[model samples]
Target: MQNTAFTTAWRKGVIARYLTVAGATVDLTGCGDHTYYRCTGCGHGTHGVSVIERVARERAQGHAETCRALPRPTH
Candidate 1:
């Protein structure tokens, strides 16, 4: 399947730290106290108080890998 629009949104960072791999959507969002990752396919996510953004990014990537949903490499 082609997800050109999804990839474009990810590349542009239109929704902050959000990514869609395969049919799963990973969204990172937070308020003043905490940040969280919400995955649609997995039906669960992680969050922390004042956690670094990279941690969340890594978690999302890990989930993608486990789900075998990583995006295909572009030429």
Candidate 2:
């Protein structure tokens, strides 16, 4: 797996976010004021207030269990 970073940027009048993890690029979708992380690898995602916070929370909550892009064992 590769070291990844989650970032967000403003595109137009909305927030655009993406996550680069283990060589896969996951595009985030925004709904209302919440952002969702959709894994390009496994097609799994969860909603958060921010992309960075979402990814961090997902990882901390053991997203690797279902995330194909991040297959490393979580402890």
Candidate 3:
């Protein structure tokens, strides 16, 4: 059995975009080089983030909830 939820980069991208639109902070880090994004009035790595689609489609929705509950930027 394989987990197909959020397993696709394209899906991740879409969710990322939604987060951006929702005014959530986004950060993509690299080994030596790093990139940082911020929301208008919020800081990075504060609150958790989620995908409505994932929650609705996942078999173990509770797992999805936990993933979204992870520490993340609040912006």
RMSD of each candidate?
7.1, 9.0, 13.4
The CA lDDT of each predicted structure is 0.55, 0.45, 0.28
Candidate 2 off by > 4 Å: 1-21, 47-75
Number of the top-ranking candidate, with TM-score as the measure: 1
Q: Model 1 over residues 1-75: C-alpha lDDT tens digits? A: 565435545533323444454555666676333556656555557734444567767776677556535534446
Ranked candidates, highest lDDT first: 1, 2, 3
Evaluation by TM-score, superior candidate among 2 and 3:
2
lDDT of 3 by residue, 1-75 (tens): 332223324323222322232323233221112222222223433133333433323312222223332223223
Instruction: Record all residue pairs in model 2 with backbone atoms less than 3 Å apart, i.e. clashing.
Output: none
TM-score of each: 0.51, 0.34, 0.18
For candidate 2, write residues 2-72 as lDDT tens digits. 34343323334333334443534455555443555555456556544444545544542354343446423
Model 1 stretches astray by more than 4 angstroms: 1-21, 31-33, 47-50, 68-75
Q: Deviation in angstroms for 31 in model 2?
A: 6.4
Q: Which candidate gets the maximum lDDT versus the true structure?
A: 1
The clash number for model 2 is: 0
